[model samples]
Target: MPGNPALTEATYYILLSLHKPRHGYGIMQQTEELSGGRVRLAAGTLYGALNTLCDKGWIVLKTVDEDNRRKEYQLTDKGREILINEVKRLKELARNGEMILGEEL
Candidate 1:
């Protein structure tokens, strides 16, 4: 598993955010809005996730709003594919765990 780091929950949501174009503050606001305020990402965490997502090419830098100088991002095709796969994997893992615990039949 060398060089393959697991994604944090915040990281995943950051990727999810890129499904639409959003800036740093927009991301934080949208994340809370999207999660019903149960999950709020701090500035530092959001920036970190943004950087990681950018570095991995999971998100592309979109238009920048110069009036406010805010940079936005959007999901790449590869990013969408990865996110989809990650969702599927999580579902499978949850199913297996529930079945093991006799919660699923």
Candidate 2:
């Protein structure tokens, strides 16, 4: 949907974050925390990913109640599927790579 999202770890993290219905900054913080600082979603990148996922029908803006400043997002069924597929792909790649490398050494 988002043009070979198959190669994006950040995308997966973003999707995972929205699985719990979180705001933009909340999503960013959660994603970073979950990845142990290995991943940081910048404002630009986060919005871009959100829009892309929305266009692909994977995610949607659940609600917006900008008090001081905030908006939340939630994952659609399609989003869950996308995330699941990405995880499976990652596992397969890891298995294959590990086997080949271990055998060679």
Candidate 3:
């Protein structure tokens, strides 16, 4: 099946971070850690991406704490599929680059 072509790096990382339910702050921290501090997401950017992902049906609100004020999100089946597809696409791009460069690093 054809996956979303408009998924950005931030969005991809966000989705990957939601492999488990996590709040906004957790998502940001995990994303940075996952990318080795290369993909730090600001609060505004992260929230916006979360809204978009939720609207796209790739993610859903998993929980909300009344007093803590933290809302957790998790990936839906569609989200997992999309994440897997994106990984495949990224791998293919890397493979093509390696082939063209003709030098394995």
Best by TM-score: 3
* Candidate 3 least-lDDT 10 residues: 1-10
Number of the top-ranking candidate, with lDDT as the measure: 3
For model 3, the stretches where C-alpha displacement exceeds 4 angstroms are 1-6
Candidate 1 vs 3: which has more TM-score: 3
Instruction: Go through the candidates in order and give the clash count of each.
Output: 0, 0, 0
For each candidate, what TM-score against the reference?
A: 0.79, 0.83, 0.89
Model 1 agreement with the true structure over 11-40: per-residue lDDT tens digits: 777777777888788778877888899889
Residue-wise lDDT of candidate 3 within 1-105, one digit each (tens)? 365475798989999999989999999999999999999999998888899889989999865878877789999999999899889889888889989986655
lDDT of each: 0.79, 0.83, 0.89
Q: Which stretches of candidate 1 lie over 4 Å from their true place?
A: 1-5, 102-105
The all-Cα superposition gives candidate 1 an RMSD in Å to the true structure of: 2.9
Error of 1 at 98 (Å): 2.6
How should the candidates be ordered by TM-score, best one leading?
Answer: 3, 2, 1
Could you tell me how far off, in angstroms, the CA of residue 38 lies in candidate 2 after the best superposition? 1.1
